[model samples]
Target: MNLFNPSKRVRNLYIKYGENPFVLLSKFIYAAHRQKWSKEEIERVISAAKKGNYIALIRILRSHTHIEE
Candidate 1:
């Protein structure tokens, strides 16, 4: 699930949706692409979630309180 080497689905999404994360990383038909959360962002979420699992990240808030309210 390396964001570095995007999968075919990601490449297609990137081409159709462009490089903006708002699209490519939004709904790429691949959970891995969606879950390819950045380490920094994950850290922030971790600092907030405090031992949270990846499943709760969809809401972001549930995963990370750092998310601007």
Candidate 2:
């Protein structure tokens, strides 16, 4: 995923969900859980997300799930 230039789906998700890191982090965690991600993987993503970078977090989410456009 492009961290600097977000895709259409990512943009839509960002707009729909807003830029709140906490909210996005929850969604990411949910997606990760739905995908049956390993605990370590989930924790790593959570760790990365704690930095509170919107684009980076969205990229991580996009990597794990399909964000329909």
Candidate 1 stretches greater than 4 Å from native:
1-34, 51-69
Worst 10 residues of 1 by lDDT: 7-16
Compared with the true structure, what per-residue lDDT tens digits does model 2 show for residues 24-62?
677666665666666677776577655656776665656
Clashes of 1: 0
- Overall local distance difference test of candidate 2: 0.55
The TM-score leader among the candidates is 2
User: lDDT of each prediction vs. the true structure?
Assistant: 0.33, 0.55
* Candidate 1 lDDT, 1-69, residue by residue in tens: 221233222222222222333342233324323657555553443344224343333333321212222
